[model samples]
Target chain A: MKPLTTEEIRAVIAAGKLRDNLFKATGVFCLALALIVIVALVADMVIKGSDRFTLDFFLNFASRRATQAGILSAWVGSLLVMLVTAMAAVPLGVAAGLYLEEYAKRNWLTNLIEINITNLAAVPSIVYGLLALGIFVYQFGLGQSILSAGLTLALLILPIIIVATREAIRAIPAMIREGSMAVGATRWQTCRYHIVPYAMPGILTGVIIGLARAIGETAPIITIGALTFIAFLPPAPLSTLGDGSTAGLFDWVMAPFTVMPIQIFNWTSRPDPAFEVNAAAAGFVLMAMVLSMNAVAIFLRYKMRKNIKW
Target chain B: MQIHDNPTLKAEARNLNFFYGEAKALKNINMPIYDKKVTALIGPSGCGKSTYLRSFNRMHDLYPGNRYEGEIRFFPDNTNLLAAEVDPIEVRMRIGMVFQKPNPFPKSIFENVAYGLRVRGENNKRVLDDKVEHALKGAAIWDEVKDRLADLASNLSGGQQQRLCIARALATDPELLLFDEPTSALDPIATGAIEELIHELKKRVTILIVTHNMQQAARVSDYTAYMFLGEMVEFGKTDEIFIKPKDKRTEDYITGRMG
Candidate 1:
C-alpha cells in the first residue's frame, strides 16, 4: 500500500485527540453532577431548618405546635439504641468473621454460609424490620422497646461487619502466622496477639461504618413499633445521685423509644405546615450525627495506616 | 540405617515416606541428626529437602491432604513424634524453625522476640527483658537493635529481620532448629554473616539447614546429605561428601555435571 500524506496522518491524530478529551470531560461532568446534587440538598435542608435549629429545639419534647417541638426524646433514644446495637453487634460479628476466615474448613457448608452472608447484605433493610416485628417484638415479647429496636438494627448490620472483618483478616500475610507458630505459640495465642492486633484497624473501620448505618436506620425501628411521639427519656443506665434510687439499667433497655429518623419521618408526614420546618431541622441533626460518626472512622483509619508500614 | 558410633544423636528419621494427596513427594528415607552439630541438606529445586526439614516439627499439619508414614524419634525421651498421641504444639516448641524468607511479626522488635516467652506464661517483666536480651545477643544482632527495641520489626532490613526471627526462636530455648533455605533471600554479605551465626549456634543447638548453595553447604555444615528427586543419594561428613561422593549422582551434582 502507498504511504498516506502527512496531512492525512494529522487528521487521524486530531480525531483521536478529540475522543480522549470527550472521555475525560464526560468523567469530570459525572463527578461534578454527583457533588453538586449533594451540596444543593444539604444547603436546602440547612436553610429551611435554620429557624427551628435552636437549643430549645434540642431541649423541648415533640408537641402539637410546630414551634414548640424538639428532638429531646428522639436524640436520647437514638443514642441509647446505637449503644445497644454496638454492644450486641461488635463481639458477635468479629467472632463470626474470625471463625470463618481463620478456623472454618473450606467445605461446601462454609461456602453456603459465605454466599448467604453476602446475599444478606444486599437484602432490603425493610425486610429486616419486618422480621424484627414478627420475632423480637411479637414472638419474643420484647414489645416495642429499645432492646427490640437495637437487636433489629444489629441483625441488619451483622453481615456488613462480618464481611469487613473477614476482609481485614484476609489481608494479613501467611508468613506472619508461620513465624508465630514456629516460636511455639499455640494457634489461639498467635491469633490473639499477632493476627488480631494486625487486623484491628480494618475490623474497627468496618464496625464504625456499620454503626453509622445503624444510627441512620428508620425502617427496622419503625417496623418494630418504635413510637414517633415519645415524650420522655429512657431510664439512665447508671445514676450516682443518691443511694441508687433513680432509674435503673433495666428500665433503659426495656423502655419505649424513638430515634431521630423516625421522629423526622413523623413530623414530615403531619398535616401541620409548621411541623415541616421541624422535620427538616430534625433531618439536619440526624445528618450531623451520621457525618460525625463517619469522620471518626476516617480519622482512625488514617492514624492506623500511619502507625503501620507493612 | 543403623548407627552405633555417634552416641549423641538428637533426632532420627526411619523409613520416612511423605505424600501430598495421592502423590508421593518423598520415598523411604532415614538419616541421623546429631546434637551440637550443623547438618546441611543440599539438593536441586523441588528435591524435597525443605519438605524433609518441615517434617521435623510437623509444619505439614497446617494443611489437609498431606500424609506421613513412618516415624521420627526424639532421643533421651525415645518418643515417636509422629505418633497419634503426641501433641504437635509440644513438638513445635521443642523444635523451632526459620523459613525460606524472613517473616517478622508486625510488632516492636522487643515484642517479636518476647512473644515466645509471653505465650508460655512468662509475664514477669524482669524475666522477659532478660530472656529477650539474651536471645538477641545470641542471634548476633543485639548491638545493632539494642537502642530500638520498641521500634517495629518490619522497619528493619531483610537481614536484620531474619536475625530477629532467629532470636525469636532462640528465646524459647528450643533444642533443635530447622532452617529452610535461610540465606537464599539474602545478599552475599548477609549470607556470610548468617553462615557465621550458624557456626556459632551449633555449639548450643542442633541445626538442620536446607540449602541450594553447594558452597554454603560445604562452608557451614559439619555433615552433608545430598538428595535428588525424593531420595537421599549420599550422607557423610562434609569434607568427605565434598571431596569424594559415594553415589555417581551425588558426584555429578557437586561437580556441576548434572542437577
Candidate 2:
C-alpha cells in the first residue's frame, strides 16, 4: 500500500478533530440543557411565589385563607421525619453494606441477597409505603404518625445507602485490610479501626442523598396517610399536653404530622388561585431544603476525604 | 537445604501445599526459618514466592476458596498455623507483613504506628506514645516524623510512608516479619535505606522477604531460597547460593541467564 500524502494525512487528522469537536459540543449542550431546565423551574417558582415569601408565610399555621397559611407544621414534620429516616437507615444500611462487602462469603445465598439489594433500589417508592403501611402501621400498631413516615422513608433509601456503602468500602484497597489484619487485629477490629472510618465520607454522601429524595417523596408520604392540614405542632418533650399530662421525649414520633410534599400537594389541588401561590412558595422552600442537604453532603465529603488517599 | 551456623528454627513449613480455588499455587515444600535471621525468597513473576511468604501468617485465609494442606509449624508452641482450628487472626498476631506499596491508614503518623498495639487493646496514651516512638525509632524513621506524629501519614514521601508501614508492623513486636517486595516501589536511595533497616531489624525479629531483585536478596538475607514455578529450587546460605548454586536452574536464574 502507498503511504498517504501530507495533505491526505492532514485531511484525516482534521476529520478526526471534527468528530471530537462535535462530541464535545453535544456533551456541553446536553449538560447545559439539564442545568437550564432546573434553573428555569426554580426561577419560575421563586417569581410566582414572591408575594408569599414573607416571614409570616413560615410562622403561621395552615388557615382557611391562602394568604394566612404558613408551612410551620409542614417544615417541622419534614425535619422530624428526616431525622428518624437518617437514624434508622444510616446504621442499618451501613452495617448491612459492611457485612456484605467485608464479611460475607461468595456463596449462592449471598449472591442472591446481593442481586436483591441492587434490584430493590429500582423498586417503586410507593411499594415501600404499602410495606410500611402493613408492617409499621398496622402490624406494629404505629398508626399514621411521624414514626411510620420516617420508617417508610428509611425503607425507601436503604438500598441506596447499602450500594453506596459497598462502593465506598470496595474503593479501599485490599492492602489496607491486610495491613490491619497482619497486626493481629481481628475482623471486627479491622472494620472498626480502618474500614468504617475510611468509608464514612462516602456513606455520609449516600445518607444525605437518600434523605433528600425522601424529603420530596409525595406519593409515599401521601400513600402512608399523612395529614394535609396540621394546625398544631407535635407536642414538645416535657411540655404539658392539652390533657394536663407531660409529653414523653419520643412523643413527637408518634404524633400526627404534615410533611412539605403533602402540604404542597393539597394546596395545588385547591380551587382558589391564591392557593397556587402557596404551593409555588412551598415548592421553592422544599427545593431549597433538598439543595441545602446536597450542599452539606458535598461539603462533608470534601472535608472528610481531604485526609484520605490510596 | 544447608546452613553453616545451624541456627535455631523459628518456624518450619512441612510438606506444605497451597491452592487458590481449583488451581494449585504452591507445590509440596519444606523450608525452615531461622530465629532472628533474614531469609529471602527470590523468583520471577508467577513463581509463587509471595504465595510462600503469605502462608506463614495465613494471609491466604482472608479470601474464600483458598485452601492450605500440610502443616506450618510455629516453634516453641509447635502450633500448626495452617490447621483448620487455628485462627488466621491468631497467626497474624504472631506475624506481621509489609506490602510492595506503602499502605499507611488514612490516619496520623502516631496512630499508624500504634495501630497494632491498639488492636491488642492497648489504649493508654502513655503506653501508646512510648511504643510508637520505639517502633518508629526501630524502623529508622523517628527523626523524620517524631515532631509531627499528628500529621497524616499519606502526606509523607513514598520511602517515608514505607518506613511508617515498617513501624506499624514493628509496633506489635511480632515473632516473624514478612516483606513482600517492600522496596520494589521505592527509588534507589529509599531502597538502600530499607535494605539497611532490614539488616538492623533481624536482631529482634525473624524476617522472610520476597523480592524480584536478585541483588536485594543477596544484600539483606543471611539465607536465600530460589523458587521457580511453585517449587523451591534451592535453599542455602546467601554467599554459597550466590557464589556456587547447587541447582542448574538456580545458577541460571542468579546469573541472569533465565528467570
Candidate 3:
C-alpha cells in the first residue's frame, strides 16, 4: 500500500466515515420510526377503550345497548370455541407434522403433499368459511354449529400448525435420535421418549401462534354462520354432532354458536350509536384475552427452555 | 492363522461394506470382536475406523441415502445382524455406541442414565434408582453423581459427561459397547479416565473402540485392526500391530507414514 500524506489520509478517512455514519443513521431512523408507530397504535387503542374497561367488562355478558352492554357471552363463547378448536386441531396437526417430518418419504408424493399443505395455509379465511358451509354444513349435514365453526377454523389453521410442528421436530438433531436408538429404543419409542419431549417447546409455541390466528379469525366463522345471539352458557355436558340447524339440548359440538369476534362484528354493524362503545370495549376484551393467552404461551416456553438440559 | 478367538463372540463383521451414497467408507471388514476384550480400530484420520465402528451397531443408517451392505453378526448366536427383519433398535440395545463427544440428553443426570431403562419400559422408581447407581458405578462416576442426580447432565465436566454417556449406555446392559472416538472431544485428563474405564470394562462387556490416539490404542486395546481409505490394512494382536506391523502401510500408519 502507498503511504499517503496527512490531507489525503484525512480526505479518504472522511469519505469512508461519512458513508458508514450515513447508513448507520438510516438504520437508527428506521428503528425509531417502527417503535413510534407501535407506541402510537397502542396509545390510541388504550385511550379509546381505557375508560370503559371496568371489572364488569370482563365479567358480564353482551347487551344490545352501548352504556349497559358487556362482553360476557362473547368472552364465554370465544373460550368455548377456542377450547373446541384446540381440542380438535392440536393432536391432528401435530400428528400430521410428525408424519411429515419423521415418516414421510422424500419422494415426489411427499413433496406434493407438503406443497399442498403450504398452499392450504395461504388460502383465505373466507374461502375456508365457504368450504365449511358447502362441505361441512350443507354437504355433510353438520349444520351451522359452534363445533362445526371450530372444526372449520381448525382446518384453516392446521396447515400452519403442521408446518410449525414439522419445524420443531426438525430442530432436534439426528444425534439425539441415534443416541436414543443406540440404547435399543424403537423408533416410535425414541420419538415418544426423546424427540417429542425435546421438541415440545417449539411445538407449543407453534400451536399457540396458530391458535392466535384462529382466535382473530372472523370471516370463516361468520361464513360458517355461527349464531350472533344466544342467552345461555354453552352446553356443559357436550355432545359431538348435530345441534345447529335444529335445536336440541344433547347436540352440543355440532350446534351453531357465536364467538367474540362474530358477536363484536354483529354489534359493530348495528345502526345504534351505543353498540359502538360496546364494540370498542369488546375489542379491549379481545385484546386482553389474546394478551393473556400469549402470556401463558410465553410462560410455558420459558419453562420449557429452563427445563431443557442442553 | 486365526489371530483372535472367543468362547462367545461379542460381535462379528463379515465382508461388511458401508457407503454414504456411492462413496465407500468401509470395505470388506471381516473381523471378530471377541467377548470381554477391548478391540481398538486404530488408523489415521479418514481411515474408515470410525466408519467400521459405527457400522457394527448400524449407527450408519441414521442419515438418509447412506447404505450398508454385507453381514454383521452378533454373538453368542451369531444373529443375522444384516437381515432386513432384524430390528436395528434391538441391535443397538445389545450393541450400544458412544459418539466422539459426550452427548447426554437435556435432562437430569438421573434421568439421562435412566433413559435407556425407561425405553425398555422400567417405571418403578426403586428399580430405576438401583440401575442408575449400578451404571454410574460401572462407568466409575458413581461418587461424583450419586448425590446430584437431579441436576442437569450438562453441569458435569467433560470427562464426567463421557462417563455419564457410558453409564447411560451401560444402563441398557449391552452385550457389546462401541466407542467412536470417545475421547477425541475430551482433554488429556478426561481421556485418561475414559481410557482407564475402557480397560476395566473389558472384563464384562466387549468393546470395539475407534481411536486416532496411537498411544491410547497401544495402552488400552487387547487387539488392534488397522484400516486405510476404507480397506483393512492389518489385523493382529495390539503389540504385534503397533511394535511390528506386518504390512508396510500398517507400519507407516503406526509410524505416521502418508497419513
Question: Best by TM-score, which number?
Answer: 2
Comparing 2 and 3 by TM-score, which wins? Answer: 2
Model 1 TM-score on a 0 to 1 scale: 0.93
The clash count of every prediction, one per candidate, is 0, 0, 6
Q: Score the docking of each candidate (DockQ).
A: 0.60, 0.86, 0.70
Ranking by DockQ: 2, 3, 1
Clashing pairs in 2: none
Considering the true interface contacts (CA pairs under 8 Å between chains A and B), give the fraction that model 3 also has: 0.78
lDDT of 1 by residue, B1-259 (tens): 2223564989998999999889888888899988888899998898899988998898887777888999999987978888878988899989999888898887899998999899889999999999999999999999999999999898999989899999999999998999999988899998888999999998899999999999999999888999888898799888889999989999999999877
Summarize candidate 1's per-residue lDDT along A1-310 as a digit string, tens digits.
Answer: 8898999999999999999999999999999999999899888889889999899999999998999999999999999999889899989999999999888888999999999999999889999999999999999999999999989989988999999999998998887887888777787897899777788889988888898898988888888889988788876766543455776667789999999999999999999888889988888898899898889888888887665655
Candidates' TM-scores? 0.93, 0.98, 0.92
Q: How are the candidates ranked when ordered by TM-score, highest leading?
A: 2, 1, 3
Whichever of 1 and 2 has more lDDT, that candidate is 2
Highest lDDT model number: 2
Candidate 2 runs further than 4 Å off: B1-4
Off by over 4 Å in 1: A1-22, A238-245, B1-7
Q: Return the lDDT, model 3, position B144.
A: 94
